[model samples]
Structure formats: C-alpha cells, structure tokens
Target: MKKFKYLFGPVPSRRFGLSLGVDLTPFKTCSFDCVFCQLGRTTNHTTERKEYVPMDGVCNELNEWLSTNGQADYITLAGSGEPTLHSRFGDVLEFIRTHTRIPAVLLTNGTLLDQPGVQEAAARAHIVKVSLSVWDTASYVNINHPHPNLKFDQLVEGLIQFRANFKGRLWMEVFLIDGMNSGPNDVKKIAQLARQINPDCIHLNTAVRPVHHDFVKPLTGEELNSLAPLFDPPAEVIPEFKTTRRPDFQTNEDTLLEMLRRRPCTSEQIAGALGLHLNEVSKYVGKLLRTNRIRKIRKDDNVYYCTVNK
Candidate 1:
C-alpha cells in the first residue's frame, strides 16, 4: 500500500468526522510555538506567507485524491504547518471547489487573518476554524508564543472581519492550558471575544495528546465544561476524542518504514497514520529500530522516528 506525504487523517474530529487533512506548508513550519500544539515545537517560525511547497503540485495531488474518494465530512486544510502560510491558499481553495462538491474547511491559528490577502483567500472556504488561545495580550504571548510581528488586537480584528464576510459557519477553537488560560479572567476575556466574533460555535479544548511544551496539561472535563456557558448558545467544550474501529485498515513494519522516509513521526503520529493502537505501533517501531530500518531522534525527551536506508 502507498502512503501519502501530504494527505493524512480521515481521523476522528470532535467537530468534523473522518476529516481528510491536507498539508499546505512544509513539516513543522508554523507561526506559533503554542504550548498545546499537538505537532510539538515549531522548527521554523515566521509570519511571511511564501510558496513553501509547490502549490500546483499539491493542488494536482488533492484533485486526484478527491476525484477518487469523492467526499468525506470535510476536506480540511491543515497539517504540521499553518495552512495560511501558503501564499497560494486562495488558489488551493478554488482548486478544491472546482473539483469537488465537498465543503472545504480552513483550520488556522488566525494570526494572519488581518492581512488583506489572507482574508481574501479565506473568503472562499466553506468553513473557517480559527484558534484563539487567550484573550489578553500577555496571556496571548505566554500561551501561543506567536510570531513576534503578530498583534493580538489585529488578530481579534481579523477574526471579526472573517465573521462579517464569510457566509459559512465560523467555529472558534480555544485551547486551555492549565493555570494559564483556564482562570476566571481568562475565561471572561475569551467569552468576550466569543461574543464579539459571534462564531457559529466555540470549541473548548485541552491538550489531549503530547505537545511541544512539557508543562502543558489537559484540563479536566469538569474544568472545561465550566467555561461553556459564558459564550452564546451552541458554544460548548469538545465532547470527547473518539477513534474509529476499522479492522480492515492496517499497516505493517515495511509500510511504517516507508512513511518515516517522508516525515519524522512520533509513536502517536505513526498510530494516527496507520489508524492502529498506540501501544501496538510503539511495539512495531521499537522492533524496527533494533533492525536499523529507522533511526531515532530525540528532542526535549520526545522520540521521533525517521527512515534509514541500508
């Protein structure tokens, strides 16, 4: 079986089920070094939107996939890097719409929304899910650690602009880090932003998977649920993280090695790719390292796997 470097998931989503994720920017390239980011640290942090990957190449690949699979719940633009960082984001959205009837969604950190070009690009998406980690500037700096050039005021303005222009649903995602954005004041500020943006829904999230910062912890469900009522109706905490059980979807050691050749993956990432249990994937990865099919790289005590050819 062939594994894709760019396309991942049809994984479980709290908002959209079985989302087929498309990576627009290069791996681990992003504007923020968020405390709760699932992908770990940002190796390259910049606000500039460049042609990180050949837009036409990615568009062509996406067309082929959509043409074959037809549609899933949502065709999401998000991957290891921030999607808006791709200068040709508008073209990508247009390309997807031209080829498929599936609703296109752009999942972004919302830092770039203030840019006229970014706003123009986002106008084409069927849904926009923007991340707002904290309400105040200090909290913003502490929690998200966004690009030095990004301003919280501008971010808030841009989010409002998106709400004004986008006809589709606007879903706001708030990631609460313990003792940081989970307090009463933080919750109040977030609630104010929610009312201002007036998104279709607000999703309260805690770090469930391993993250870039060792200090970040997932808030208790009870803690998250407490913040739900502050926003307007339809605003609530994420229900639960659910995994699908499909026995037919399976990957072997050889298949896993092939995937590592293209991208470095943690045990969790490998499991996500294969749709297998983490413990099961960890056992296979451990075995492969002993055989020297893969090499291990340690960053901040976290292990990542990459292919090593003999």
Candidate 2:
C-alpha cells in the first residue's frame, strides 16, 4: 500500500474512539515544547503560523481515504505536531466537513486560539479540545515550555475568546504532571481558570509514555481519580480503550507493530484486539522489546506497548 504523507491513523483514542489522523505540521513543529511530550523534545519551536506542509497534499490523501470508504469515529486534526501551526488548517477542517459524513475534530494546545484566523478556522470543527495544563505564567513556563513569543496570558485569552463564540462542543484537557501542576492548590486555581473557558466537559490526562524531562511523572489512576473532583465536575481519567474489534488473525509481529503505531496497547489489549492469546502477545512483545522496536509504558495499572522510532 502506498503510504499517505500527511494522513496517518484511524487510531483508537481513549477520548475520540477510532479516529483518522491528519498531520498538518512537520514533526516536532509546535509552539510549545511541553516537558511531558511523548514524541520527545521539540526541534522546531516557533509561534509562527504558516502553511507548514502542503495543504493540498493533506486534502488529496483525505479525499483518497474517503474515496475508499474510510470509516472512523472522527476525522482528527492531530498528529506529529500542533495542527493549528499550519495556516491552512481551517481549510483542511472545511474539507472534512464538506467531503464526509464523519465529524471533524481539532486536538490543539490552544496557543493560537486567540488569532482571528485561527478562531475562525477552528470553529469549523465539530469538536475542539484545548489544553489547560497550568494556572499561572510561571507554571506554564515550567510545564509547557512555550515559545518565548507566546505568553501564558495570551493562551488563556485565546482559549476564552475561542470558547465565547464556538458553537461546536468545546473541551479542555488538563495534563497533570506530578510535583509540577498536580498539587491541590494548583489544580484549584487551574480549575478556576478552566471554568472561565466553560468547556462542555474536561478530560484529565497524564503522561503515559516517557517524557523529555525526568521530573515529569505519570500519575496513578488513584491520584487522577482523587484529582478529578477538583474541576467543576469530575474529569474522566484517560485510559487505553479497545481500538477496534477484529475478527481473527494469527500471531503476527508486523500486525502488532502496525497497531502500536496507531496507539499504545496493553498485552491484553493486543491479544483482545488481535484475537491472540496472552502468551502469544508476550512472545512477540518480548522480541520487539529486545530489538527496541517497541517500548513499555506504564499507564495507570496497565503496562502498554508502543512503537519506538529508534
């Protein structure tokens, strides 16, 4: 199969179900070099918004996928880097809206939400989820490591303004890192700011994979559960859910690798999704682990296996 340059997954997202992904920006091209970014440190850190990649190429791949009867819960504007960093991101969203029945979704860091163009573009999505990981500028610097040109206040203002007029479902994702912004008082203040945005709901998440900094740590389900009520309403703990139900397939490492490329999966998740026994999953997983083809990440109570670039 010829690979789509700008299109990637109908990956299973715990929050968004099976979602077809659109990568608008080049790898690591983002406004914020967040400490807990699983893709590691950002190489191209900038606040500049332009056509990062050819927008027509993305639309072409999307049209091809749709032509083949691509099925997914959502057509997601998320992959590799922040989608909004691309000036034509709105056009891509518009393409999905006019071209398909599947709803479009934007998973953004909320940095550019204040820009009039950005707000107008993002409003095209059926659902937009923005990030709110810090309460103050200091904490924003500590956790998100935003570009020097980007101000924490500007981030808040943009999110608030975007929410004020967005008719679609708005959601806020609070990424909690231990000893960083997960403290009770910190969450309380963060909650106050989150309420100002008035999202339809909030989804509390933690770093599930290895991060750029050692200080950033993933929270336990218990810790996340305890912190859920700190928001206006309790937040749903992000968990690895079944991506898709498969009929049956023999144990294949390539199949496992392809699945992990989409989203991290537990041994049981791999087994259940692939219709393999736990022992069979362990065998392939162990081989991949030794070769560094895949890595293990502890998410809540489960051990997840995900693809590694190296």
Candidate 3:
C-alpha cells in the first residue's frame, strides 16, 4: 500500500474490522489534548473547522483507493487527531457515499458534538463513536483536556442530542486511565451519564499502546471486567467484539520509520500505519535500527525504537 499524507489506517478496530480510515484534518489539529492520546500532543486546539486541507485533493485520493481496493467493512473518518474538526466533514461524507458502498463511521472526542452543524454532518455516517472518559467537568478538564472554548455540559448535552437526531448506531468508547478516570466514584458518575444518553453499545477499553503521559496504563482484564456494569446499556471489553480482516492501505517501511521518528509506537500501530504484518514490521524496524536508520529510546521502562535520520 502506498502512503498518503491524507489517510493512515484501516487500523484494527475492536469494533470495526479491517476498517478503512480517512484523515479529514491536517496532522495534530484536534479539539482535545487527552492524557491517553496515542498521537502524542495537539499542536492546534481550536474548534474551527475550515478546509485545513483542500477538500478536492482529499476526495480525489480517497476515490482512487475506493475504486481500486476491495471494499472495507467501514470507512472511518479518523486519524492522527479528532475527525470532527474538519468543517467540511459533511462534504467529505457525501463524497465518500458517492464513491463507495462501505458504511461510514465517524470517530470523535465528542467536544464538537454541541454544534448543530457538526451533528448534522455526522448524520450521514452509519455509526458514530463518542468518547466519555470522565463524568464531571473537573475530571473532563483534567483528563481529556478539551479546547478551552468547549464546555463539558454542552458536550454531554450534544452527545445526548446527537443520539436523538442521528438514526445510526452510537457507540460510546470509554478509555479509562488509571487513577485519573478509573476510580469507582468516577465510573459511577459516568455510568449515570451513559444511562441518560442510552447509546447502542458501550466499549470499555484500556490503554494498550504507548501514550503521551507516563502515568497512563491499561487496566487489568480483571479491573475492566469488574467495571463493565457501570454504563447504561452496560459496557463490554473491546476484545469481545469479533475480529475481521486487517485494514488495507499502503505504507512503506520508510514511512513507518518516519512516523516513528517523532514518537514511539507499538508493533500494532506500526503495522496498521504501514499495512504490514506485525512480524514484517518488526523485521524492517530491526533492520533499520541496526543500520543506524533509527534509534531506540525507552520511556517508563518500555522501549520505543524510531528512525532518527532520513
């Protein structure tokens, strides 16, 4: 698979299988600076959604892939940052529908859901997954670290409203960062809110990959299992969902190494970015590091190897 600056994964989604993903916003442009974000930190944190990248350029590239490749289970609008920040997302969604039969899925942090136009744009998507990490405003600020312009009350209300207006399935993904949003009191409050919203499914997930902060760690299987009953419809561990084919996309070892230059990634993220098998990715990365194409750094006792030179 050839790498495109505009698109990245059909990364293994615990929910959507071999899902084809589209990056609507430019890199690192997001509405939140989550403590558990895999992409590191946010460079831009405003809610404004202009055509950050030319819409026509992205559409053309997407059409090319859709027309040539086998159909994916879902066409997900997600990438290095929040997908909802793309102001022309409605146009992008419409463009995707015109070109492919795959269902559209929108992955969002749920900060912008308060905007009517944002909600309207999402209506075209077959599924919308919103993140509900913390229950109260203080916890939301401490953990998700949304744009200063966004309000926690408005975000929750917007998600609730989106559930009402959109006819598609709503899946709420709760990434429980230990000691931050995973305590009994926090889970209980979040469950109350989930009950009010009534989403179709509640995905209880823990950090499986390296994240921005050193403090983040995925909850033990036992911890997640015990906490599943808090959400309205009740939550389930992400792995409970059936696995599908790996996502189809293009990426070279060089591209994978380039992405790794800035941050550390697990084998899964590297494979998803490059469209390679995990074993294959390990082989290339090992080869590169040995040849001085990259270097390895360890954080929290975890080794992250990356390309240090072009």
Candidate 4:
C-alpha cells in the first residue's frame, strides 16, 4: 500500500460506512473551535478560505488510491480540520465526480455556507453533513467559539439558503452536551431552528469519544431518545460504527508510531483510522509505551496515546 500525505483511512463511519477521508486543511485549522472536537482545541481559528494544501497533490493522491484500491462506500471530505476552508474544494469534488463511481460526501462545520462561493462549492457533493449544535448566539459562543466575524443568525441563514438550492441529501447534526445545550429551553429553540432549516434528516450526537474539554460530556441513550422528538424532521441518535472492516495498509509498529507522532489517539480511534483490530492496536500501543516513544494521557475518562513530545 502507498503512504499518502493528504489521504488517510477507509475508516468505518457510523453515517457513511467505509469512508475514505480526504484531509484538506492542516490540523486544527477551523473557523469554529468546539469543546467536543475529537482532534482537541483549535490552534489556528480563522474564517479565511485559501488553498491550505496543494490542490494538485490532493487530487493526484486520491486518484492514485482509487485507481489502486477501488471505491469505498463514500469518499469523504473531512479530516483534522474543516474541508470547506480549502478554496478549490469544488474542483476536488468535481474531480471525484468525474473520476469515480462512488458518492462524494462533505463533512463541514456549516459556518462559511453564507458565502455564495462556499455554498456553490459544497453543492457538488452527493451528501453534505453540517453541524448545527447551538440555537442562539450566546450558546454558539459558549460551545463553538467561532471566529470573531461569524454571527449565529448568519450561520442559520446560510443553512436555510443552502438547503433551498442544494439538490443532494442534506443531513444536519446537532451535538448535545450534558449540561450546556440539553435543557428543555435550548432543545426547543434548536428544534425550531431545525424546522426552519428543513434538512432531510436530523442526527442527534454527543461526545461519546474523548474530547478536549473535560466538561464536555456525552448524553445517555435515554436522553438522546427523549430529545429526538423535539425536531420536526426525521431524527435519530447516531449509533457507533460496528464493522469488521480493516484497513488495506499494513498496521505495524512503525505505522502506529507515525500515527501517534501526528496526534494523540485512543485504541478505538487507532483501530478505525489504521484499519487494525482493537486487540492488534493494543499490542502495538503496549510496545510503544514500554519503549517510552509514547505516553498515555487521560481525558474525559478516555485514554489517549501520543508521542512523548506531544
């Protein structure tokens, strides 16, 4: 298997099974830095749209992977940061459409959809999944901590307008924190906003995995179920991925070290990202810990392994 710089994982995904992730932006380069982000805090929080990574390199790598490995369930535009922030995002989507039979999916924060260019670029995807976690400006600031220029109402307006024009499936994800936005009043306001946006489906999610902030907590099954009815759209709790699919690449000690060198990850995340079994990941992780190449850190009751320097 080839070592790709920009492409990683035909990882099992709850929403899109066997998702091949195409990372566009650098790590933590996003407009909104949410407390529940799996990749931790935002290091570079901005709303600027530019070619962060070379467009030609991304397309070439993606084309090479597809040519060799064939298709997954979906070729997802997602990674360590926001995909839409790449200025040539539409071109990449167009390349996927022209080259492959597989569906193209965009996982975005939905902050920049207000811009006509961003909306037009996003429309190229077969399915666009956007996050709408807060109902008002106060909650938005509290949870998301978006760029200074972004307004809560503008973000909502963008979703509404984008839905009206986009022909593909529009799935809206609402991330719930235990104490932040799970109250009756907050949920009701979110439900009302969901109605106005009129997405094809509403997905209720929580911080089930390790998050940056200790205060960010996952909602239980019962809580998620109770909140599902608040939305007018067909809504359900997003389930965890339970698949036997493994990565095509070799999952060896060196591979594990390389992954950990990039960022901290749990056994499950390592398994999913590298296509290794949980048990297999544990073996490699244990060896790394013994070698003192990596150290373990606990956050939100979940353990993560990273390089000693990290």
Model 4 lDDT, full chain set: 0.84
Candidates in order have lDDT scores of: 0.77, 0.81, 0.76, 0.84
Candidate 4 residues lying further than 4 Å off, grouped into runs, are 247-310
Assess candidate 4 and give its TM-score to the true structure.
Answer: 0.83
Q: On residues 40-154, what C-alpha lDDT tens digit does candidate 3 reach at each position?
A: 6788887887887788888888877776674668888887578777878888888877777888888888888888999999988888889898888899899888888888999
Backbone clashes in model 4, listed as residue pairs: 247-275
lDDT of 1 by residue, 1-310 (tens): 1345566655555677656777887757888988877666788998888988888788777877766764468888887689999999888888878888878899999889988889989988999999887887898888888889988898999999878888888888888888877887878888888889888888887765545455777787788887778777645877643332332223365678778998888887887887654423544564565456787777777778888862
List TM-score per model, in order: 0.81, 0.81, 0.81, 0.83
Better of 2 and 4 by lDDT: 4
Error of 1 at 103 (Å): 1.0
What digit string (tens of lDDT, one per residue) describes model 4 on residues 1-310? 5657777666667778777788899876999989888676799999989999999999999989987966689999988689999999999999999999899999999999999999999999999999998998999999999999999999999999999999999999999999999997899899899999998999998866555577887788889999898888647898756433554323466788898899898877987897654423544565466457888799787788899987
* Candidate 1 segments whose C-alpha is farther than 4 A from its true place: 248-265, 268-300, 303-310
Poorest 10 consecutive residues by lDDT, candidate 3? 241-250
Q: What is the C-alpha RMSD of each candidate to the true structure, in Å?
A: 6.8, 7.4, 6.3, 6.3
Clashes of each: 0, 0, 3, 1
Instruction: Please report the candidate that would top TM-score against the real structure.
Output: 4
Could you tell me the C-alpha RMSD of candidate 3 in Å? Answer: 6.3
